[model samples]
Target: MQPSLAELQRALAARILAEEGSDLDDWICVPSEADSAARVAVYVQGYPARIREALRETFPAVAQILGDGSFAAFADRYAKDVPADLQNLNLVGAALPAYLESDRVSGDLPFLPALAELEWAVDRCFHAELLPPFAASACSGWSLDEWARARVGFQPGLALVCAPWPLRELRETYRCERSEIDVDLVDRHDQVLVYRRGFDVVVESIEAAEAEAVASLQCGDALGEVAAKLAGSGAEPAAVAGYFGRWASLGLVVSCEACPLP
Candidate 1:
């Protein structure tokens, strides 16, 4: 009895990813002296190679840290563990940060997972849909009372990543020079804002207090509420005002709507 088309495809995929459990000699015919298995081996080898290339493109910093040989081995294992399910190849490494954090993939380096997270944010920010920045003139008509109740909506391209490592510096260093991978990993915590400015993706390191305020605003809190929270945390009223203005100037805030008064 012949195997179904779905069965054949499953077997082929299993063989390509795991390099096991499929004998193509029965179904495949080769005209040359080379056996049918040899022909299938070409595709089997190419499968992981393609996945590795995609991973390298997405996580270049991780690849640099791991080196070519180690990265290749890591990519092979990752490919086998998490096969690409989406039609788009760029989404292949979406789960890589989590995989790196797993105990299964142990490593001497502790910052690899955080670096992967930062790289993935860059990739995502680059491809995110562009929305026209909110016009500053829109705020001209709001009264002091109305402003208190306003809720600012962040841009779709905005991403806030709080990491235990100096991810922004690490990413920039690797990007500037792959050979210069020496970075001190102790006592460095970074709150990074990843967003697209026009055509470029910008990753900026922010102060912890500012990150807290931004996170509160992003969560749909009213402006007055955020200001109060910051004030309670020892931030002055003037400083809170400046922070909101800076975010607006940076094109981070998209929409500012006054919450309806009850």
Candidate 2:
């Protein structure tokens, strides 16, 4: 019997996938075929190559850590599993950690995944559109009660990443290295926040309390709750206040619903 439209489409899709050298299929077109397979291979393979190139450029430190061979192998598998779906290649490696954790590509490089996460987040922040400036004067209109109940929204580009390695410093230092770097002893775990301050990507090594506080605020927690959580951790209220001011100055605060008068 002849195949239906859906079946033919499916077979054609399979043929396309196979010609692209997909491991899912044995062979696509027979030798009698002209330059069809050859032509298709160019487009198919370019997808993975382009994705790998973008990731390498965005996360040089990760490439350095995994070495060229390992990096390429991992990137190839990542491409096969997660095809390039976004127009922005910067987000290409966002799921790398989850991919690494899977049994297929599991390795001893636990920290490599976290490093990649931080690197991609930083790159994303650098390219994100500028947000409206947070007015310090906005605080003046709110009373103490209203301020306490205010929920804060973070800037679009700010991302708080908890890394098991000194990803923040490692990335900055690697960018400045002359020849290359030998991955030496690395910190077990660290907390880093990547935010775009003005025109530059600013990476700050923040404490756990600060990370949690920022995360809570991002979740739309009321100002009083966020402050209470920070205070519970023995974080100085004055110091936290200063940090908040600096963050606002950097265009990190998207909007604060309510807050005490300045």
Candidate 3:
């Protein structure tokens, strides 16, 4: 009996993954002329090739860490282990670090995955749609009491990364074409604030306290609560207010909802 089209497709997908020339019984037999196995190989090979190319472009620092050959091999295996599901290929490497942790593939460059994560965040932030800027003056109509309980909305592409290395600096200094290198990806710690600043994505270092403040705000905390968190870390109230104001001016806060003024 002839196999159904769906069955053939399933078989082809499986065959593409299997080792070359291994006679797996369930595989759809390739016709002599078409050579289904070879055809499948073409897709399987291209899958990782495309992914590696995209990732190399996105995370040049990661490429530098792994070098050309090792990076390609790693990319190929990672693709086989983690299939792409998103329409936007930009998101393909989002979980790469998580995958690397369990597989122990990143042991040589222990911080590589975190760097990749940071790089991916920057790429995503750059591509996200910008929202209309929010001005602190917009809240001027509200009484002091009303402003206290307002819920703040962040811009579409804000991402915070906590890493054990200075990913922001490393990526900034990384030049894929450079013939010589100097940065060491060793035991250092870094946190990153990635946000869309106008037409560009800006990745900058942030203190732990600042990261916490952003985290609190992102979790829907009231401005007062976020301010309290920041203040406890010795951040002056005036400075904190100014920080949020600047953030607002940059379109970092998309909207603000106020509480009833007392």
Candidate 4:
């Protein structure tokens, strides 16, 4: 009996992704004169090649760091291990950072996963929806007590990434200057703020405290709780206030809502 369409599709997909144990001839048909295995191999080879190009587009800095040859190999391995589950090619590399962190590829380049994460964040920020900034006038009417209960909402594109390597600087160096990566620079921790302003995606280095505060806000914490937590963690009130002002000016905060009265 002939296999169903779904079964044939499943078998072809498995073969294309280089999964083991799929007999190509069992699912594919070719003329007696034509090579069935060779035809299947063509699709198998093209799958990773297309995915590699997409990954290269998404992670130009990482591609430059790893170079063409190495990046191609890495992309091939990643595609095989984690097949593209999304219909959109733009999101194909969504699992790449995790793949890099897995035992399959993490041994040689410990920093690659973090670097991939930064790149992915930048890509996401560029495509994320834009919303109007929270009206500054709304804050003027709030009493100190009312302000404490307010929760801040961020723009859709905002992403904070904390990594042991200086991912932001490395990304800039590779992207802007096309310079060689410095191995010594990966020794320290760094936090990056990624967001879109107008048509450009901006990547800025931020202090650890600021990253934490933004993370808290992103998690729906109220201003009062975030402030108290920051104070407990050794951040001065003035510093926190200043950071909030900066964030507001940058249009990172898109909405503010007061907590319900108890």
Top TM-score hit: 1
In candidate 4, what are the lDDT values of residues 99-213, reduced to their tens digit? 8888445577677889889999999999999899988898888887787888988999899989898888777656554455565664679999999889799999988888888
- Model 3 ranges with Cα > 4 A deviation: 19-40, 176-179, 184-188, 260-262
Judge candidate 1 against the unseen true structure and give its global Cα lDDT, from 0 to 1.
0.82
Residue 159 of model 3: what lDDT?
88
Candidate 1: tens digits of C-alpha lDDT, residues 15-90: 7776577754566668878777777889889988998999999998888878788889999888888867898888
lDDT of each: 0.82, 0.71, 0.75, 0.83
**Where is model 2 more than 4 Å wrong at Cα?**
1-41, 86-90, 103-106, 173-188, 259-262
State in Å the error of residue 147, model 3. Answer: 3.3
Give candidate 1 regions above 4 Å deviation.
Answer: 103-107, 176-179
TM-score per candidate, in order?
A: 0.90, 0.77, 0.83, 0.89
Q: Ten consecutive residues with minimal summed lDDT in candidate 1?
A: 102-111
Q: For model 4, what is the error of residue 140's alpha carbon versus the real structure, in angstroms, after optimal superposition? A: 1.1
Order of the predicted models by lDDT, top scorer first: 4, 1, 3, 2
Count of clashes in candidate 2: 1
